[model samples]
Target: MGDIQAYLASKYMSGAKADAILSRSEAGRPKKKKRRIDQAVPVAVGDGTGLLIADEDSLGNGWGQAEPEEEDTDVPVVTAAAKTLRLKKSNWSLPSASSSTQPEPAAEEPPAESSTATATSAPPVKKRKGGLLTAAQLKEEAEALAIEEARKEAEREQERLEARRRRRAEGIEDDEDLANDDDDDVDDHPDHQRTVYRDRSGKIVDAQAERAEQIKAEAEDRARQAAKKDWNKGLVQRNQREVEAQRERQVASTSFARSANDRDMNDELRNEVRREDPAAAFLTQRKKKGPQRPKYTGPAPPPNRFGIPPGFRWDGVDRSTGYEAKLFQKINERSRKAKEAYQWSTEEM
Candidate 1:
């Protein structure tokens, strides 16, 4: 009966269920396999007693192993807890409480490739000891720079002023030399001496009077010369006009005399013809018997009183007697005498 019950339980129950029942039943029993120094072991001293034990190897290993696992077995396992425990033991091991409580070490940073590049390719930045300056120091530096610029500017201005002064001195020397040369020239020529005249009040008056007289004489001379030129021009023009008129009159007189002579000859010839041919003369008389107006024999109207007729004199004097004409003649005579006197005075001066 006992063997049959064992067989039935073995066939029907799982390995884990069997183990659990056995562990409960054999609570005071020792495990078969002993743990190594780096291993974890769970021991059952009695009912409800669970104890874990770790060795020096477990303490020495700071972290659990993380290596890759081998391939799983093809056959299915009957105990999940056992398989899990094995996997835990192979892949990882828990640390002691003291070790777990300790802080972990920080990861080391990777070395930079740029550090070597920078050292080789670039110059180092120099640190200035006096990088940060005080307000007083800054002010002093600015004032020093300003003073330096001002000094340089003043030096340049001084140089320019010195150059101008030198030029002015040279110009003054040249002027003095020129004055001396002029003085020497004046001293060398006695005939070209510059006369300095001084005039008192009376001498000034005499000079002014002489100047006025000279000006007046010059004016009179100009007037006389102008009047003479005008009079000559008028005389020439008047003579030309008279000559033209005489020529025209001569021409007219010659033509009239020729006509008269021709007429007289014709009359004498006509009278001879009349005496020689009384019958012809009687015929001519009969032809000339037409009525004719009497000839105007009265003297022609008096010539234009104001304007001179052809053949009349062109003298500027009027022969008629009137107060105005006499007055005009007197004015002409006075003007002529005045012109003659002016001419004489200018000649004498």
Candidate 2:
């Protein structure tokens, strides 16, 4: 039985196949060769115990080996039986404790692929909200721009006004030329009050008065030359003739030379007469007689045909009139006033 169990384990054969093959063993059934376990099968008597039978000739050497194996009393039979049982147990295997309950490794590959796809397929990002300008900042920028534009506009206006003022100063425009053209306004003598030298009818000049002025001027020149040692005698003689001719135009005096007593008496009498008939008294009387010059309220008038009054205008009427009339009135008024003011100031000085 032990030998049959060992054979079943070694051959990895089923129990039924092993039994059938054992039955077909010619030595066990009809061969001339001996089979010990088959022969002893009928003699086996208990569990865990088996018998072995041999022919007399085979037993002679095996009996001596059995005797030697049995010397320890627990040798050959127990060894063989334990070996066979161990082999049989190996053939009929049992499940390991670690095998049936363990779990498989998880699928990490899909998750890794999903992460890669998400990274590659996303859209481009927009900028953050903090970069944009605030409302107050935008308003301030607009105000600054407006101020700069206004400043430029003001500068342009000033330049235009300055250019116009320069043109007017240079007499480039008609309006400006009229304001400066009044020669009567300027003082004639430069140092004295401007005396209007009008005629006897307050129109034509007095020839006698003009001649007296020439004689007075010649006398003054002769006195100056007489004082100088390098006086030109020829110039003196020529000037004397001019003075004689001028004297003839005035009223003539009979006695040419005067005595010392007569000269002194005459000078005293003349002084007394001049003191009585003062020049200021004469002018004041004259002013009271004629109409005073009209006061001017603005500039001078423009020229017209025949050089009469300037342009046509009215005396005591509404000032705001047509363009040419208003222009002439302003010019005439300014010129008249300027002349009067110049004369008054020079007289005061």
Candidate 3:
């Protein structure tokens, strides 16, 4: 070891550096404490794509063979997120050239987080198509898709509801355009489109069964309508019979007074024997026509609202005496007050 140090010092380095190198080297080094081989960490290497596991076998620089690790009893195993290693200069013998192991290519992991998050979370390495999807994962994805679709449907429904509210507020009479989803061309061309039947649980059912149910319902409806018609006919016939029997009874009850002036007879029959002019009609006419009014045949005058007679004309004269005018003014005041009272009542109503 001293000769090797002297040779190194004379050839390539100072004596102190040579001694330090020899001390740190394998041959003349002191016995070191044994480190657990299992504790050796595997570093991760990046190849511009993703993190990749790096081991000593990759770069032809591996630790020496060591004993198997002791069994762990109480200490929990821990995984480090990352660890850094600084290589120390050493004189290591290269592996045999004939029995070499080739390193695999880099970029084993993905680069993007959003697209590869599911792939990284999956258990299998096969990420193509449905290979990596587990039962639970597939179910979750389906539920998520259904939820998204439901959210979109709810938004559309909300928009439709708002539109309906706007139309109603504007006093528009509209039954159409409430929902375009149902009012599509499919509704107008129902006969041209294929009809699909679905059961109560939304699963597609047999068309024959569905049609049979519809026919059964229609038949039941028709039977009900027929039964109702028969019931109405029976009720009408019963009513007619009762009316005829009542007419016969009335004829029997009123047969005792089958004369023209009988009170039970209708007005048209009684009128045949009625005396339009009574014995005191002359006195009634005298009372109703106490005064006779002369009629005017000329064109009617422009109506004056001041209680003037129809054909009378004012001669620019105040012919009313003072007492008569006072009496007329009082009457006019009373009428105006009555009119005001009527108008107030109308406003309250």
Candidate 4:
């Protein structure tokens, strides 16, 4: 019986299958390492309830009927159970169908009550469009920015005005110092004292007289420059006018010379024509007669034997017309002979 079964098995087994079986058998067919179930460490299921079951044997039996086991005394077992409980709770609370398929999020377990309270109390943050503000919010923000810019500009303007006032004050002080220096200079110089003058009314007028003279000299120089400029301008205009007039005169003279040459050429042509053909010249000079009809005096003279007039023998009639005339004559002769033969035949009959 063992030999029969072995032959049947060998017949059914392929060469590759036999090789695989042989290899596996030679390798001692690796024993599946049994997974150690930590009875103390509670298995967390999808349900959020933290009720602990005894072991795998109890887990296979419906969870509803399974009695809760005593808490493990080991610290690690308690920590792991606590972690699993947190993970289950978080997974249960998540509002996503995909959360069931995903592996448990490996995160530090947060207090359930605190997380729930925060989630409940805080309003859901709405997603923004392109992470940007709405139109109204943007407009308000722009107005605020513009107001801030205007305030800063006003402050800068104020600072500028203050700086300008300070500068003006400094300038005034400098001018006062310069005036004092000028007074000191006047007191120190003997020439200034000698030049100083007062009118009978006791008003100082020497500087005014010098300034008037200086202004008069400046005016004269400006006037001289203006007159020189005007004179130069007039001279340039006169030269331009004269140049234009000369150009016009040259153009007129050239035109007159050309006209004279044309007239002379016409006269020479007339004289040449008179020498070449005097009769043609006389015909050209003759007066033209008015239109008149010719008188019908008589019939034309008969052509000679050669079918040409006496004066037209050298200039014979056109060949095409002569052929037509000969054909007409032959046709007339044939018609006459036919008529005469018909008369003779009638007399004989």
The 0-to-1 C-alpha lDDT of every candidate, in the order given, reads: 0.58, 0.56, 0.62, 0.61
> Can you write out model 1's per-residue Cα lDDT over 1-349, one digit (the tens) per residue?
5444445556677787665655554564444433222233332232223443434343334454323324345344343342255433222334565665345567987678777766654333333346788888777676766666776798898986676578678875466556756888988897556443446643423446677999999999999997787675777787897898987886676644455557645765666644456577346452367787554344342344354343333343445547655666788899999999999999967
Task: Please name the candidate that would achieve the greatest lDDT relative to the true structure.
Answer: 3
Model 1 steric clash pairs = none
Any residue pairs clashing in model 3, and if so which? none
lDDT, candidate 3, equals 0.62
Tens digits of per-residue lDDT, candidate 3, 110-142, equal: 558867786644333322365577888778777
Candidate 4 displacement at residue 104 in angstroms: 34
| Clash pairs, model 2 backbone | 199-204, 298-334, 299-330, 299-331, 299-332, 299-334, 300-331, 300-332, 301-331, 301-332
- Model 2 misplacement above 4 A: 1-131, 174-349
Q: List the residue pairs that clash in candidate 4.
A: none
What does candidate 2 score on TM? 0.13
Task: Give the alpha carbon lDDT tens digit for every residue of 1-349 in model 2.
Answer: 7556546655877677666665555336433433222112112123223433323542435443322222322223323332243321111223466656345566666677788878864343333346678898777666766666776788898887687679878867665435444534554546346354685577856567899999999999998876674454577886897787876764255366667778645765545534446564544332357666655444554444345452343453444447666677898999999999999999967
Candidates in descending TM-score order: 3, 4, 1, 2
Superposed model 3: Cα runs more than 4 Å off: 1-131, 173-349
Q: Which residues of candidate 4, in runs, are more than 4 Å off? A: 1-321
Candidate 4 residue lDDT tens string, 1-349: 5444445456677677665655555466344533333333345444436553334654444552445455423233322343454432333343466655566557888789998888755343333346668889777666766666776798898986676568678875466556756888988888756766778999887777788999999999999997787675667787897898987886676644456557645775665544557477446563459986554344454333466443433343343446656777888899999999999999967
